[model samples]
Target: MSTYLTILGFNSAIPTVKSAPTAQFLEMEERCFLIDCGEGTQVQLRKAKAKFSKINHIFISHLHGDHVFGLPGLISSFRLLGRETPLNVYGPKGIKAMMEAIFKYTETYQGFEVIFHELSSKNSEKIFEDNRVEVYTIPLDHRIYCNGYLFKEKPKERHLNMKEISKYPEIEICDYHNLKRGKDFILKDGYVLKNEVLTTAAEPPVSYAFCSDTRYLESIVPIIKNVDLLYHEATFLHDLKEMAEYTGHTTALEAAKIARKAKAKKLILGHFSNRYADYQVFLNEACEIFPETYLPQQLEPVKI
Candidate 1:
C-alpha cells in the first residue's frame, strides 16, 4: 500500500508561539522526504512523530531563512545519532555554501556524507528520478529564485492469481514470479497461458506537490495539474491582497484558486503571516473557493 504525506509546520516568516514557518514531512513507503526545513523543524518533526533517521533527501524550495534554517541542527542530530547513510540534499544555489559555512564554523563532524545537488534554473523539469519516485521543479514567481517540488510514485507490478497457481502446484513456484512480472505461463505440453488469465493490474501510484512562499503565478498550473495532494503557501487573507502581492506571497483565496485551476485532488494551505491571530479566516476564505482546501497547523500531521 502507498504511504500518506504529512504536514510538519505551516506558518510564515515570523514564528509565533502557536506556529512555525514552512516545513513538511512526506512519509511514503518507509522513507521520509523533508521539504523546506524552516526554523524549529526538528522540533516539529518530533512532534509529528516522524523518524528523522529515515530522511535521506531534503528539498529546499528557496534560500529564504523561512524555508531552510534548520539544516545545521538537523545534520548535527544525524551525526549524533550515529547515522552512516549518505544524505542527498537538493536545493537552489547558495545552499551548499551556507551548509559549508555552518559546518566549518561550528566544527561539526558528520558520520554520513552530505551531497548537495543545487538547482540553477527556472524551467519546469525533472530534477531527480529513481525506482521509487520522480521529483520535478516547478518554477514560481517569488522575490528570490524559488521552485516547488512534485513527487510522483512509480507504478506497481501486476498481481498474481493463486487459483491458477494451485493447478500448477507440481510446477516450480518460481513461475508465479513471472506472472507478477506480467508474463505468460507456458506448460511443458507447449500450451501457453495468457497473462490476463493469471494476473491483474495493481493500483496506480499517486503524486503529491509542494508549493510554498510564491505569488499567484498561473504558469505553475501545468506543472502541478492532477496531483493527488498539493500544499501551497497562503500567507495572508483576501483582505490583505495588497500585502500579499507586495511581499511576493499569496493569499488564502489565491492559493485555493491555483489548486482549483490545477485540478488537484486536495489542497493544503499554510505559511500564514504572523499578522493573523487566528487561522479561521484563512480556513474560511480558502474553503469558500475550494471545498477541499485545508489549513495545516504546526506539528499537526494531516494524512494525504
Candidate 2:
C-alpha cells in the first residue's frame, strides 16, 4: 500500500482509560510521520507496532494539551533509544520555545538535533517534500493558532507493458527505464515509438487530509478538494452547535459538510467530546450529509 493512516488516539480534552487523545501515525510513500503528539501517544504507538525510528518528522496541529502533551515524552524516548538522526518538527511559531522550556525544566537532554520549522503563515504552504511525497499545512481556526496537514504522494512511474513492448524487437531491456519515464524510443531508422504505446498509465497519486481541532471553516474546502481521505474533528452534535463554536470545535454535521464540499472520497470523524456516550450518534449524524463518513477505527491502519 502507498498510504496507511493509523489513529493512535482520537479523544478530545480528557483522555480516558479506553481512549487517549488526538494523535495519528501516517505512513505515506514509505515515509512515516507522527501527527499531533497527544498524551499516551507513545503507548499507543507501541500498541500499533510502529517503528519509532522511522518517524523522523512530526506535525503538530496546535499547542493544546490534548494535542501536544506527549511531544516532550516522545522526544525523550527517542533520545533514550539513541536516535542520531535530526528530527524535523513542523508547528506554530512558539513550538520550539515551548518544547525547549519543558525539556530544560524537566532536565531532558537530546543526543540529536531537533530542527524546528516554526510556521506562522495563515496561508496554505508546502511544509515537506521529497522524491515520493509532499506535505502541506491547512491553516485552521481554533482557540489557538492551529494548522492541519495534507499528505500527497508524488506521481508514480508508468508500468512497462511487456506484451506491447515485445512486439517491437528494437525496444531493449536498457530502454525500459526511459519508457517508464514517458520518453519515446527512437529506432535506428529514425522511426519513433511513443512511450504510451509501450507503457501503461501510472497509478494516480493519492492524498490524505487531516483537519484537527477547528470550527466549521469552509475556507479549507479548496485546499483539501478531491482528497482520497479526510480525518476531521467532530467534537459535538448539532444540538450543541453554540457550545461547539464557543469551544472552537466542529459538529458532526459540519465535518460532513466540509467533506462533502471538498468532494472527499472517504471521511473519518474523530476528536469526540467525552460528553457523548454513544459514538454511533456521530456516525449517524455525519452520514446524513456525507454517506462516506465513518467513525475512526482506532489503531487500525486505514489505507488512503
Stretches of model 1 off by over 4 angstroms after superposition = 169-172, 184-194
The per-model lDDT (C-alpha) reads: 0.85, 0.94
Model 2 TM-score on a 0 to 1 scale? 0.97
Residue range with the least summed lDDT across 10 consecutive positions in model 1 = 295-304
Relative to the unseen true structure, what is the C-alpha lDDT of residue 81 in candidate 2, on a scale of 0 to 100? 93
Tell me, what's the RMSD of every candidate? 2.0, 1.3
Q: List the candidates' TM-scores in order.
A: 0.92, 0.97
Error of 1 at 282 (Å): 1.9
Per-residue lDDT tens digits for candidate 1, residues 173-272, read: 7776777778887778878878888888877778889988789999999989999888898988888889889989999899999999999999988887
Total clashing residue pairs per candidate? Answer: 0, 0
Give residue 253's lDDT in candidate 2 (0 to 100). 98
Candidate closest to the true structure, highest lDDT: 2
Residue 201, candidate 2: how far off, in angstroms? 2.1
